[model samples]
Target: MSYSSHADEDDDVEIEEEYLGDYASVRSIVKEALPFQILATIGGAVAGFIFAGMTNELEMIPGLIVIAPAVLGMRGNISCTLGSRLGSAIHMGLITKIENNPELTNNIYGSLLLGLIMSIALGIIGHTMTVLLGFESAGILALTSIAVLAGVSSGIILSVIAVLLALGMFRFGFDPDNVVTPSIATIGDIVSMLMLFLSAKVVLML
Candidate 1:
């Protein structure tokens, strides 16, 4: 009814509007980020398929069918998991060097160590499976074991790389969400396959 009262009401409304605007922006960011992450994951899987064709000529059918999936899955899974975990840590404002967060550093190290153990185990399993199937590959078991171990080691290395990249990107004013997951997953796929080959070579030489 009075001019001052009307002015006061207008000021209150503007404050509410600003708050709502901030809330909406936050929600939009969440909505956009989640879908982007999902889409990136699917795209990474597709890329793996396309790259498998390049290696298909190497071992032919069985190589593409068995070896490709094993290497690809192991790398992708490990890298993606580690990347996601690191990203979450950054999001929670818990990112510090080992000197700062020894627990975090040790946890990541332990995970990588476990990966190595799994790699050895998987190698044994791969070799045993091949033998059980009556495949005439004498030193295949040893080769398989080494290959998996090598892959695990490679995965561990890549996990470290991913963490470094994510931290650096965050420090350089980039979103870890956009920087870490996709890049790491793609790199992991390629590196895992490469390590698989290297492991096979090492075992063959032994």
Candidate 2:
């Protein structure tokens, strides 16, 4: 009888956790995503302000803003995917620790490589579209160089943050999958914008 009582208590606790974590209904779905949305909105506003302050940089490197959205989106997508993968790994018991794991290392490497290729492609596309639309372009080489530099740098930073944040949240008994997407979107926006502006400055000097 004692064993049966304990089992019932455990089942109740599990049910409560499921209710809190899962989107079984509208209230639960909002509960899961609301905080992240609030944070993401604030981050996006900050990013817009940062972009506004880059007027000088914009003039120095024409058409850079055209690729800003692409850069931010790419970073967010990669980081979100990494977070989701790590969360799954944690739940599946594949990763008990964050450090010294081959899986984590390989994931980081793959994200970086993908970012590099996208950076080059975005640069070319941005330049081509700018010229085709009769807008001033800083040239294919300059735009491509900036994208590669900024994309690689932001990708490295964001990949680490994604892994660490997801692991930390999972350890704390929070739903990393629920939180990672919005959290990464916010962080990725800020980091990608900062890296892009800095890269533009560096490319200007070259």
Candidate 3:
């Protein structure tokens, strides 16, 4: 019995060591991801500049300035969550191929629903805040329209990008967790800003 116990302990130690060595350490993750993170940050900064350039037009819509940042941030949040989920699925071997699987469908639907709900909430909150601050603002209908349109459009695009990045990274033997979130965030910034601008234009015209 004592000998059996000792053998079990050795097996456990070997398994633990193997597991520890299989996973990435924090330093290694940071080193591998730093260059991509820097590039993504630069892309986000360019998006910010583009957003700044559109301030004149954005100013024309009352309370839109308040909604812009919230919408952009929410896009990143939603897309990052999606990316994380895909990365986990990839690591777990749940996603063998990028097809119309139930898991992928559910994730896409959930992200879209979350984006829509959050967009509407942000619209209402932005309108209320602008009113409280003694600023002129559009009605809830217009605000909601703009938010939903922009968020849904951007969500669709970002969802596809997130999935593709996860799959591509995994296929290339790179951990998706190390690259997907930052990449999605940067792309979300650019795409969300552009979508918001276009949505606002369309909403105002209608």
* Candidate models: Cα lDDT each: 0.65, 0.87, 0.88
After superposition of all CA atoms, the RMSD between model 1 and the true structure is 6.4
In what order do the candidates fall by lDDT, top score first?
Answer: 3, 2, 1
The TM-score obtained by model 1 is: 0.65
Ten-residue stretch with the least lDDT total in model 1: 56-65
- Structure candidate 2, residue pairs in collision: none
**Candidate 1 lDDT (Cα, whole model)?**
0.65
lDDT for each residue of candidate 3 in 113-162, tens digit (9 for 90 to 100): 99999999998998999899999998677788889999999999999999
- Global Cα RMSD, each model: 6.4, 3.9, 2.2
Query: Among these predicted structures, which one has the highest lDDT?
Result: 3
User: Which is the better candidate, 1 or 2, if ranked by TM-score?
Assistant: 2
Taking the tens digit of each residue's C-alpha lDDT, what string does model 2 give over 25-138?
A: 567667777899899999999989888888999988898988888888887888778878887887788777767988878888988998999999999999999999999999
Give each model a TM-score: 0.65, 0.86, 0.89
Error of 1 at 73 (Å): 0.9
Error of 2 at 28 (Å): 4.9
Candidate 3 stretches with Cα past 4 Å from truth are: 1-22
For every model shown, the clashing-pair count is 0, 0, 0
> What would the per-residue lDDT of candidate 1 be over residues 134-165, giving only the tens digit for each residue?
66334445545655665676777786788787
